[model samples]
Target: MDLIQRLDSRDADFASQLSRLLAFEAEQDESIDRAAADILADVRRRGNAALIEYTNRFDRMTAASIDDLEIPRADWHAALAALPTAQRNALEAAAERVRIYHERQRSETWTYTEADGTMLGQQITPLDRVGLYVPGGKAAYPSSVLMNAIPAKVAGVAELIMVTPTPDGTRNPIVLAAAAIAGVDRVFAVGGAQAVGALAYGTETLAAVDKIVGPGNAYVAAAKRRVFGTVGIDMIAGPSEILIICDGKTPADWIAMDLFSQAEHDELAQSILLCPDAGFLEDVRAAIERLLPTMPRADILRVSLANRGALILVRDLQEACDIANHIAPEHLEISTEAPEVWAARIRHAGAIFMGRFSSEALGDYCAGPNHVLPTSRTARFSSPLGVYDFQKRSSLIQVSQAGAQTLGRIAAELAYGEGLQAHAASAEFRLDKP
Candidate 1:
């Protein structure tokens, strides 16, 4: 599974080639869209009754009552005690790092008063309620619990509700323990589009949330898109992706392993390398060939590399930087002499790894930054979930007698230009002269 093309040779159609390379993300999963829409519509129209029916049908869990939706406190404690001491400690440590990082991101409300008696400021407030979805069963992610809930906690969101899919309507001990560590206020055993629906539109047991976050399958993403207006969503995340930029100094095995990290996620996952040296690219390819056979997800990795992965040879480091900025991968690893020098040029990316030592796995678990990020080139326009995601900002303005007179004239003029007579009249009335 290898792709090699000289940068100069593709110059004539480079734009279209780049466009095509980045365009795979535009291919929507209509099946997921249709399925999620049906579930959302049903839940919106019928409320808990529809939610229960769909959960039973899809999740195969008979949640007869709203009480069945939430995991009990006793269960949570039992799960925490059940984990091995080392794993529990790791979770605790990860939680601490996550909380500390987000604490710095916390915002405060402020007000400013001018000499002219005009007051202007910004008010920062946390959402009253939020919903976090943690994938369960084989896809259970304890790290996601820390990434999603800690930010809301730092932002001071009052009620942080967590929902995870359970094949048998049972919660995972690790997930429960992680949620507890992360300070998730509530736990529910509901997943997929239906869980998202329950959060967007309140069910009897699960209260409606101001925002929904965490990663999910294609169906889950589609559900978030559908319920966007009903409740807030972090982003419509796509398949995971990673790009490694090296200058031939790094070990081929290390580079190959990093590519495999994201490749094992899914067949659609992309792992690309942008390097100026063709010889190094061949070494990385040889490493992949030798190593791919030993990995457990070889089938998935092979398909991912063959279809989504590529190793493009550029003319120089500048060309590599240009291509990386255009791709804007979710995880970009710059393995170079001065990674920081190239890092400053990167204007867009979800999360950037600075050196060879900073692997994608580091960012996934213990790194200070959030692992939940925009995928499939969405990094160009979106950002990772952070303290800001859980907080809302309000513009503050106050007008004194003189300040109103000073500003109302311009306001009236703009309103009049838009043919909003009532708007103009309202501003004029505030500054009306006797």
Candidate 2:
């Protein structure tokens, strides 16, 4: 809590600790694959029978028939009527924003012709259907509902099937309300790997989906990993994380609380602070020490911080930015004087919050961008779920005889070099006609 201890180098083992902490990427037991394979096989083999059994076993509720799996139209209306006007209005406003942002991400089919009359372009098509999994425990994120569904809607997907688990076999009114608001085509009372299996393989009740997108617990994540080849998945996301770069301008209390917001997600969640000023570092550390005792999830934050979180004292803001690129956190907050400058320098992150005023929570709910982000350094390559995830692209190419001959020689040679006689012959035969 004191300045001296806050600035002390006692815990200088950040590198070794980070190596161990990030190793959680492989924490899921190998048995998860086996279990998922069994569930997938059952669903593929038994269809509705497997779904009902898994629902009873995993969700603790029995679905007597396929009809029992679908949420009634009456329930959707009731869930809407149950919400307070203010919350309903809030969801509407958020949905509008989400729609506007994603509409821009939408793609259009295009074609172009060359001088030789060769036509080549791209054909963009929305998936016929998609499956979105919404987490039913702890909290109901209507924002996630908007984030996942709006993109599919904008991408022109015909059917948007959604699955969520209910412990009491009773759906959350708010979640149902959000589903209706997002215009979801179907709602199923299934959760866990079973729900994923149902979506991936298609039971008599649920149709197979082209892609599955959403967030879930360890079991769900493991199932997604196992069923990857069977169906497309958004990403194998890990625990939430937030890394902030600050200077003396921002208050220590604010920084401490911001970090804790992400840390409270779970013990493995990471909250890091990278700053140049040694004095400001100590102040923020003091704030963390002072505030930790009062937080309800203090124990969780403590473990999260001790494990993957840190108050790293970099030499300068440039160094802070460099280190951030190396880690590629899920969320990056720049609280320095010129946050925009720092944010522009950021090459990788699932989401970026610039300036002291723009809190990370803003993006979580009200902000238009999807909150389903890449985690565990996956931001280095992947992006958050969006309209693109709901859409597919195919290259379009056409060739006149002249154009075919012009390009075929190179193609044939490349194929021959790779010792693919069939491939070389296929191209050569077209050219040989002339």
Name the weakest run of 10 consecutive residues (lDDT summed) in model 2.
1-10
Model 2, CA-based lDDT: 0.84
Candidate 2, TM-score vs. the true structure? 0.92
How well is each residue in 285-322 modelled by candidate 1, as lDDT tens digits? 88888998999999999988887787777777777788
* Regions more than 4 Å wrong, model 1: 1-16, 25-31, 432-434
lDDT per residue for candidate 2 within 312-357, as digits (tens), equals 7777788788878878989999998878888889998999998998
Worst 10 residues of 1 by lDDT: 1-10
Model 1 reaches what TM-score against the true structure?
A: 0.94
TM-score of each: 0.94, 0.92
